[model samples]
Target: MGIVKAAMAEEESKRQTAVEILMKVGFLDHCEHHEEIIFTVGGDEEVTGAYKYGNANWTAYQGSFKDRKDMTDHIKQESENSDYANDGCEICRSMFEKD
Candidate 1:
């Protein structure tokens, strides 16, 4: 019972961390499921990005920013406050690396 409880707690923690990362990046609304979560990104009410996370995988199919610099800046600033700031999703590991 204790072991099962511990695993459940860990899963919840990971889910929360995923939410925190998405929220910091401007994802205010999301759809969650047992196997995955999805979020739509908007800039000036225009759809900019489509993001999905599943089983530890994070994927960004599109991005809307002034430029690469702008995107990087936004990500860097928001991630600074998260516990996973230094440990981004595998797909984003390169984009969110420490400065």
Candidate 2:
């Protein structure tokens, strides 16, 4: 029964992993899963966040989130404080926290 139990455990782990990957990539709809998770956001690269889909590390989709709150919050938290700011429009600037 040990082998059977181990196999079941491994299958359960993989199933959970797949769900996490799908959710991380924006297929799942809500922050409840990560509501309490610590976030470490960084600078505004060509894209803001990375998600894994299938077997790949994927950047956030353009116009994915309903609003910028999730993205902006992540960016503000991740990005180091910078004196050099990009000249951005209202829409673009909304994605970054104002000083």
Alpha-carbon local distance difference test for all models: 0.39, 0.36
Please, what are the lDDT tens digits per residue for candidate 2 over residues 1-99? 699997787555543443343335433222234342322222333123322133233233323333344434333332332321322233334545554
Determine the backbone clash count of candidate 2: 2
Clashes of each: 0, 2
Model 1 scores what on Cα lDDT?
0.39
In order of appearance, the predictions have TM-scores of: 0.31, 0.33
| Segments of candidate 1 deviating more than 4 angstroms | 29-99
Worst 10 residues of 2 by lDDT: 46-55
